[model samples]
Target chain A: MNENNSNTNLSSVVSNRAWRQSAPWIAGAAMAAFGLSRRSKSGLALAAAGGALAYAGWRANTSESDQFLARGSVLLNCSPQEAYQRYRNFEDLPKFMFHLESVTKIGERQYRWVALGPVGIPIQWDAEIVDERENEFISWRSLPGSELTAAGSVRFEKAPSGRGTILTAITHFDHPAGKLGYAVAKLFGKVPNFVMQQDLRRFKALIEAGEIATTEGQPHGPRSLKAAALKLADPDRPLARSAPMSEILKQQRRTA
Target chain B: MKAVCWMGTNKMSVENVPDPKILNPRDAIVRITSTCICGSDLHLYNGLIPTMEQGDIMGHEFMGEVVETGSAVQPEKLKVGDRVVVPFTIACGRCFFCQQKLWSCCENSNPNYWIAEKMMGYSPSGLFGYTHMMGGYAGGQAQYARVPFADVGPLKIPQGIPDDKVVFLSDIFPTGYFGAVNCDIKRGDTVAIWGCGPVGQFAIRSAFMLGAERVIAIDRFSYRLEMAEQGGAETINYEEVDDVVQTLKDMTANVGPDSCMDAVGMEAHGDNPMYALDRVKQAFKLETDRPIVLRQCIQACRKGGTVSVPGVYSGFADTIPMGAFMNKGLTMKTGQTHMMNFMQPLLQRIEKGEIDPSFVISHRMPIDSAPQMYKTFRDKQDRCTKVVLDPWATATAA
Candidate 1:
């Protein structure tokens, strides 16, 4: 309960993406405006403190923020019952969610999750399943005061003609709308919608097939520097593709 | 262990990398004896495919001795010291696609499914040393390499059958067979094929084996044309002939062949303006594939006939004659060869003396010469059809 109050206080201060960047300047400008109105020394100081606190509270609460929601859905060729049964096992999340390193079932309804945040930073938190509607719906939220604040839910529904199950996942982060790939930007060259969609893809693969397909531990050549460079370059490419073939050939020959 | 690594486009190197160990439960470590540079690998060399990172080990067609086996690899399926030919396409035997004999379409194989799904809707099976879009598993160009889904994909070779006899089962021979099978041959039906590369050579023989009445093979190189002719195909030097499609039509009495197969894919060569445009567009990243051969195959195919593509197309192609394809009521059949489905049957054919897949090999070199061999194969140097690499061979052999 105390944690929840601290979260509310911190969120009001840290909620706005614009505020995080521009708050100091905004506070200074407001202080200058208040200074001009004060006639005495103590009066100005007290008024300055009060005004600063009040404006911060007002701006933090009033700014449009923290409604960042990420979502994706996939059509899995399996029954909803099987899909639900498999997904609710939080430990298996690492199998599909690429950035998610591990999820440990701590209690009947709770899980301790460790995930790689932006730039592959390890961020761990505790979350609990808040709601369930057997074979149809499940929801979870991170505990109060966690470094990364997020809530997520999943839904499973049977499709027509016995085709399969439709699985939808939604995650809401304590971030502004523009930073859609905020948390997972580094691991997937900025991923949130795409990552969630890929997560659901692996979940679909896992349900229809017996294993989550992966090449994580497989061998490749010594490509330490190039992989990192490619990750950095992906977001800047004008088109979706890169390195034209003919240019690549000419470049290779020149280098060779 | 020394392995062939693709450092960049058109760049291949033999690097001493650490030996591979079993990565998955069904994985096996193959001490590679013979691995070949595939024509499809040229697609990668030319940077036509996406998701290939620098320093990715390169080679998909290989045969070797099993040195180690994962815990889940059953003794009945595979064991240490077993001589085996590993199929390029990885498959989990339990997948729905694998159970139905669509081994190349096995959903459980590709780990990087999302990348492929972004391009091809659904990913097919993972392939060794291909691209990350196709599972990006380290290829068998190395001396010792990992083989995943080992129980499902590797076929054991008997002692009497030499590595040369059965090694092609790993990819091209079966791939060529699959291309021929794609033709849906009615016995005595004439089938026209484009590009008489190694796979095309195999396709020529496979077409005859599948009862093709007459096989028309097209390519510019004489050595390749000679090999296809040796395979009992009536060859055409596409560069020598003006309007090769018309020549094909005239040869077929203006009716065209019953089936047309494009053994060439993205990097198709032609002596025309359309081909030049394809190169420029591909160079400028305007189109991802040069589909000149494909256009010809579709144009030259008889009405209601099938166009079979055994070649690899990485991404988009422009100016395909869809009007010719659709208005003529033609059908198209193509896929990465479901390698496991054909490896065993083709191996049996080799055992029975019906076919010696080794006839396709024009050069045998040590792995260290891979960088030059890649160029040799790419440029068709010294009449190179297919070059087999012995990973164990030392530098002096070159």
Candidate 2:
């Protein structure tokens, strides 16, 4: 009996879509031909309706390709200038993106990112900012010869209260191996999205919670001792003062 | 000739493989009598850990009799028939890192050079049968194993204690003690541990031994929770509780657990009630999450508290809230277990009968039946907490 029931169940499952699709007319004909039990007929009607709803839901939710969309907003209780100053520097990427090794500015509008990829793989990507509205929005697209290329955008908007700005980011990526890649992405893509969202939140917190350090008085690459001395001697004048080191030392000593 | 080989996930079998000959002067052949599967071994069985070639011999936690010694080995201190427990970590004591007590990062010890480079070039200390990254040394799961760095790695199992009782001292015991030590728990501090797995359970017990005022155990498993309670911990079933952090805060007078240890490593399951998805993201790598617990521990600890992290962690990339950590003024210390450093103190504690870690062992079977036991333990069936495999037992006896 169990074996027969299992066989029937398997057959029904195999024919489920066809049965549901043709159920309305078939049920009406069955009701007319044979006085079917009211309960069984009602049960079949419910099953058909439920299956149709489920299929619709699945179709709406499931994407054919591995495409994922995640949205996150953070209220930074600070000015847009403060947020921009904190985030504009590429060196600050590590504070938010944990896996990022470093971000190097290739050009005024382009940057290169190196990060530890999934399963210990090293991944590198070059990105150019396509759209940039100062302290409002920044959008970037992956350059050629990039591993796991993707497009993403970050937008800052004045909050309703006017006390803070809301930061939002959107990203899209293509899986590595097509359908199989999509399946794997479907399995684990949510993890990266979640991580990215958390990183953004951390970035918001960091920007809002600090006094922006000025680039002034900070060392800019390597400078010779003489160049440093000249800069220190005249803040306003651009290194026009030239004097021998011995003469300068003697003059300073004599004045003392 | 016997060696344990992985057939598949949670499927291990003992087969007559070629006998190991002494390949180096530093090598010593041990006739294994007591060897057990570790919690980390489950990572291999579940296929979460990668780069495991099939037919790898599979035990790291072991104790054995010295059946043969290599030519250059000083046989004076270790002779034939001497019973000893080999640490899960193997270090060439003379290496640069080893001299500084950084055994886990010894240059000569780690077998997986490529993996080491990927994980910041820090070598994962040599371990028995853990994989190529862990030195690929055949583990004690078989009848015989070639033990390298025998003088520095193997500890003579002291007399009078049952082999089963002291077997855990080699790995789980020191690991647990190390957790407590790492947390920097003081004489009167409240500690909370996530996951009552073997290591976590030992962490709780060791916390009490280290003089903790209270130990809160959090887990979904009732049996493990009960074990925690028996070990003098206040149990928190995360499944029954909704707000874990809030509940813990309420319990600890608005301060979170002074010290928190996450024994649940990287292959974390979502079904676990105490599982923090946010924390997992912050502590992505297996090695980093152990330290991530320190982040939460920092939030929960009192001002000026110290967080100790004894859980094993590796990998280069980990996201931690450095701003929060610095703001909280929390101090943390963590590294691989200097098992040799912690052994004498733990042995002294065992000798005084002040601690009984052996009670954590729930199952004992012969080496041949390990495959089934691995499945049971992996699935956490029958509330199996810890399983010890007796290598000398016949297949039928198991």
Candidate 3:
């Protein structure tokens, strides 16, 4: 048990070190893209900064294993208690989490989760909640020998301004297909930070607005660049808004 | 339904497309009675703005009767058969920005908020029929449009007011008023306005209303200048004048105007070599906007004065003269107008006969002629200043 605990501690240190070096590279890339599109003189400077940061990050990650951590935080218009209560309920995750198939409680503090993998394939994992602090935090890790090795924690605390609670979600996972899968997901805009942020936004929407509002199906003004290109391949294919039934039903109830 | 669809750069067609339906709970289906080709729409027609996909319906200034209301729409506020003018800025009133009356910066309205936030540091409110970056909500230039946040944006028109008089309230009128308001014009102040287009004409009038002693309107087009004159402003023909800056300085005792407004946004014309540079760069997608008017506005405003820009700039403008702007201690204010803030007051102005807003309308045509009219309006042909379309009208053969 002591050896296993030391191993987990060593891995956490390595993951933290990787993130400390990589976060700037991610931010720099986003800035460089923005600057280029704006055509500002500063864009070149941003690109240089991004290139340097990416190089530094690559060097830092070369010393570590194929594991990474992504952390995101959002202010919700609710108390810390409420935020913790909702997050502690494993069954409620799929409601606000996209691409999650199901999270079923198996035993005391143990749950089995099914999620959509990279290419629409179903992937399953069993997790056990290792630690939980009431109205504050919950930590969980995938059971040994599971399909995927992952761990995460949800922390809730009052915001500095006293306006509401700040919920921070920290996820640590190994890409199933290793570094290649991670790169592909990042290119396709499903980067860990982006996914976490989106999930937090949906959680905010769900808690504050009762549902995530969408313009899907009803009508859209224009096709996004990628969607427009895809139209060239399948000329007659109809575009969908990609809104799920939960969101549709929520909108229906509001309208009715 | 016959809707105006953007085909490509400098191409448009009145095509038959599927009618818009209520996709959101807060939506309402409006049967468009009248829609106008805005000066900003010319940017889309000229392919100046990016993220414009084929078949994107264009036209932000419009009004019509509410044909259907979603369940979330309050029947007391908006109902079927009720005439209303929808604000071009789509805002969900519950957001933190909206509560402060900054309707254009609403957070929850833009579904494409990620794209907008990627370009701009943060996304503003969604706009009807603008671009994919602004929620990509279908615009009101067709027979029918689905208006999201209908409960917040659509202002009901009282009996006796014609569509022409009230439709401007949707965009240009409020935009011009906001531009003038942003100028912070003091009593007996001189305001110089660029581009005597509809927004400029309204800005000229709105400047006077805000106690500007004189508004010197600049443009290359004589007809638009004439409209500016009709709105009671002195005019400067930049095409005829060698030095617009010297002319404005001479007109203002060499102090320049107290506040200068740029009503012409992305596609500005000037005799300077920089304008040519912008054209070449824009043609090659090297730059997104021609910053001539912004440059001129900063240069022409008095030291420690305001530069109010109601013009829509999609992307970065080159050679902005930041040194001059900083050294002069000039203040700049620019944004998509928060129309909800001024709609009621401006509606009262029209009701009191303070000004006839429809005086700027130069052509009324059927929607079928939208394709040709887009060119005519962009080229400033046939004395056209603004073109209003009757969506249901049968066009006379060309």
Binned by DockQ into CAPRI classes (incorrect, acceptable, medium, high), candidate 2 is incorrect
In angstroms, the error of model 1 at A112 is 4.8
TM-score of 3: 0.82
Q: Give fnat of each prediction, in order.
A: 0.43, 0.00, 0.25
Q: Number of clashing residue pairs in every model?
A: 0, 4, 1
Q: Is the docking of candidate 3 incorrect, acceptable, medium or high quality?
A: incorrect
Weakest lDDT window of 10 consecutive positions for candidate 2 chain B: B282-291
lDDT string, candidate 2, B127-162, tens digits? 777754555566778788777767777888766788
After superposition, which runs of candidate 1 have C-alpha atoms over 4 Å from their true positions? A1-64, A74-82, A98-130, A141-150, A158-165, A176-190, A204-212, A217-219, A222-256
Number of the predicted model whose TM-score against the real structure is largest: 3
Q: Regarding TM-score, does 1 or 3 come out ahead?
A: 3
lDDT of each: 0.77, 0.63, 0.77
Q: Candidate 1 overall Cα lDDT vs. reference?
A: 0.77
Error of 2 at A134 (Å): 64
C-alpha DockQ for predicted model 2: 0.01
TM-score of each: 0.81, 0.57, 0.82
